[model samples]
Target: MADPPDLAVVSQPADLTNAWLTAVLGAAVHGFSYERIGTGQVSDCYRIAVRYAPGSAGPASVILKVASADPTSRQTGAAMGLYDSEVRFYRELVPHLGSGPAPGCYHAAIDAGSGAFDLVLEDAAPAVAGDEIRGATVEQARRAVTELGRLHTLTAGRPSLIEAGWLERGSLLNAELLTQLYTLFLARYREYLSGPQRSVCDSLVTAFDHYLALMSAEQRGLVHGDYRLDNMLFGARESARSLTVVDWQGVMVGPALTDLAYFLGGALPADLRRAHYDELLLTYHAALGPEPARTPEQIREAVRRQSFMGVIMSIAASVVVERTDRGDELFLTILSRHCDHILDTGALPLLITGG
Candidate 1:
């Protein structure tokens, strides 16, 4: 293979020339075509069909990710260091994750000052992205949680990674901001919210500061801050990976169970999640192993305490991102399911009482 390309990051799909592809891919690329992929508001994704020189080695197709075209969203991504964190994840953290859950990063580059970034990644074709509105099947949910457990297990308590600058950065979503956002969420979405959903939001907003403090004090590790269905791609029958996680822009060092709770909160209907809750938890806990020695009850409580994360995500993300018809539906679906999870787990009372 040729030496790593010294090419600069391309800011948009129009800049993906054959010469640039050949250099970054370390192969002779005669031409390529790309079509947009995913519904991400903060960034754009494209599936590139590479036409390489005969016998030259390279993936036939790869996923190319770049900063969002929307100036507002691009600014938001840069301001929050989302682009930098994702670049660092592939450049710094994926090696440790092994072949666990994330996609293989072929190339990653970011210009922090400009927030211009690009990532070429393995195309997990045939593996369909999960649907937050439709929710996941029992089998899909099981696979997702199991992989999440492995992710947490790999990074949990690793002293070297625990304090890394990229992972340890503080979230901008503090209590005051969340409370303000929740108020805005209510103004826009209140009519759509169920009575229970409204109650859940009220409780969370009431205790936002206390909740943030409590969660911050808990055991922390690498967490996919937005670990919900939309960010996941479930595998096909013959696929190598059962799940391939994407969108590491929100990755951070935080309470690991928050990922679990965030995922479970929206990946299934309330009834389905309630019915299979223990089995799913056991699957994750078992995959996590016994190093930390958390009992079933402890895990349950931790998940319950962390359940409000999805609520926060739904409200905050819905308001901030470029809104669309699908964005509204997706966020509403997430909010409804997560409110149900909170009610089922009694997360509101737990937050109020500081458990």
Candidate 2:
């Protein structure tokens, strides 16, 4: 495990609470100003509205994500590459897609060899605000499909093709991460769950490494290493054409369809997802022109290929859900129900090996 970035610049959570008054609003920053916007996952976000000089329009207002260097984050430690990978992703990958769902990258810098950094980002709030009330729409899913098609097509044969000197975080998407996840889950659940259900969970965890090894590696291109609806930012349901996908921490190189199945099936309900699943896969196929991998067999295989990854990721999600806000019986019950349903039905049979 590589050492995470040193964020001694702002140590401790209490320091985070008073970040605005201390850092952004500090005397060091000139010509521009910022305020503490909110905390997200492990990082603190700020609305970094800038100001121009005497007669300069300067750049439009932008948002800055102080990349989380919390050693405690699931990734364990942070690296400057965490921020740099995002910048590199926007630089190398976003252009190939042209106008698509990705959020544009603004200026950013991480301490070389240290991994401490902050990222300036294009504002995508108007799009994300819609999630407060409703979820993704059919149209939004279609658009995402088209955008993904562009992604899968343009970078058809580039693995680790990042710019020289730029670090690619999460590039290590090998068997190790999954193995660690399994151990973590088992340790967390040993006292909480037992019996046959626990046995199934253990089997699933153990399969993490096996699947990683058996998986075939395609020409890796812009993989949304963690693809799910929650990562997308959308406008009002009536007009979500301007959806911008956020969260670049997990960007990596791998099969593009992995992102597709994860987004379409992992989060949404089966019926809702089933309706447009074939259509979305077709959209990806169309990118390779009229005669690409468009066969029914090919589509099903790609889906199954990706769905296996989803099951592993779902295990990761389960571990988190099981320990969150304990005593919420309703939530716990729902979690238990989902776990039982999936395990018994082998709903995500990707865990059964031979994938």
Which candidate should be chosen as best, given TM-score against the real structure? 1
Per-residue CA lDDT of model 1 for 1-355, tens digit only, reads 1226577898888898998888878799999999999989899999999998888879889999999998888888888888999988888888677878989887899876677999988888879898888899999899999998877777764657657776877667777888888888878888998888888888877787788788888777788788878889998988878899999998888886889988888899888999999999888888887774577788898898888888888888888778799999999998899999888887787766775
The lowest-lDDT stretch of 10 consecutive residues in candidate 1 is 1-10
Runs with alpha carbons beyond 4 Å of true place in candidate 1: 1-5, 290-292
Give the alpha carbon lDDT tens digit for every residue of 177-243 in model 2.
Answer: 6567667756655565546556655655666555555454543346776655556666555543466
Cα lDDT for residue 72, model 1? 81
- Give candidate 2 regions above 4 Å deviation: 1-39, 69-71, 74-81, 91-97, 129-135, 157-180, 183-201, 217-219, 235-241, 287-296, 314-355
Q: For all candidates, what are the clash counts?
A: 0, 3
lDDT of each: 0.85, 0.52
Query: Which residue pairs in candidate 2 collide?
Result: 5-78, 80-115, 127-234
Q: What lDDT is reached at residue 328 by model 1?
A: 92
TM-score for every candidate vs. truth?
A: 0.95, 0.68
